[model samples]
Target: MHPGGIKTELGRHTDPVAEAQMIRTINQRNAAAGLPPFRYKTVPQGAATSVWAAVVADGDVVGRRYCEDCHVAQIAGDPEVRGGVQPYALDPDRADALWELSEAMVGERFDPLN
Candidate 1:
């Protein structure tokens, strides 16, 4: 699920020196597209959609991007548009690549996907 932004101090451990530079660069890109800089969801609210996808939603919901409040999202093909899923990026091949890379990074510390 594209959990959107969360209000937690999620990245507090990041290196302060690099954080501002990165945020500036990214927000500059967002500004170029006429979108506001990144904002966040509250930590408690952030978990709702994920919990729905993982525990409550049925198998038919698998492999689809979800958003908060648990409805099927509007697809966001154009960056100018507000919230929505970019379905082209969510295919199985990309997912497998992500899985393999994650397993390579932490296979010794955690159980890996089959």
Candidate 2:
């Protein structure tokens, strides 16, 4: 499902060559928009449908393991961070909160956005 809620169920692609072509098309579109190339991030279980999610890491979107509920964007000057999912007004505070929350998980720096 796309951020706009558009869903596409790519059923079993029996044609490997055709699947590759479709992927190439998607990659081209992403590249033209200055976004990262599309790659399978997760495989959703279902019928013969091919439900794929991409590792979306752009200036306006961040793809992470834990933070997947909301859309987060990369914050400049913080390369260590992947990105955050809040507006500028809530960034600093959210960062502090994430840092505190992460203290219990990983001891790494609380990088909210990159």
Candidate 3:
């Protein structure tokens, strides 16, 4: 799930100064494009969906992409919109290929994945 800018320690690890600048630039672009303002969430809020999928949701809903909500599909994006989901994002073949590539690159298939 895309956690939607959670209050992570990410800023501290990376160049916080640069990330702040980036946020401003991106917000300006989003505003100019008429998109809603982005916001941040606490760690618990960000972890809610993941925890739901792990502990509460049925097997059918596991391993699927979500946005912020548990057991919900990511909002399929329109091609006309900026930052929209691409066709490949929903392609089974592409996903399989990416999985194979990631395992190879990492030099191991994770225990549960096998």
Model number with the top lDDT: 1
Write the residue-wise lDDT of candidate 3 on 1-114 in tens digits: 555467676756768788788777777767877876556768888788778877887767555554345555544454433354466677878878888888899999954352
RMSD versus native structure for model 3: 3.6
Tens-digit per-residue lDDT, 7-114, candidate 2: 245545347798779778777766766666655533333211212224433523333322332333333333222223334434667667767878767766654565
Better of 1 and 3 by TM-score: 3
Weakest 10 consecutive residues of candidate 1 by summed lDDT: 61-70
Cα miss at 75, model 3 (Å)?
Answer: 4.3
Winner on lDDT between 1 and 3 is 1
After TM-score superposition, what is the CA distance of residue 7 in candidate 2 from its true location, in Å? 15
Candidate whose TM-score is highest: 3
Q: Which pairs clash inside model 1? A: none
Identify the runs in model 2 with alpha carbons over 4 angstroms from their true place.
1-10, 44-114
- Score candidate 1 by lDDT: 0.68
TM per prediction: 0.53, 0.30, 0.65
lDDT of every predicted structure (CA atoms): 0.68, 0.45, 0.66
Worst ten-residue run, lDDT, model 2?
A: 44-53
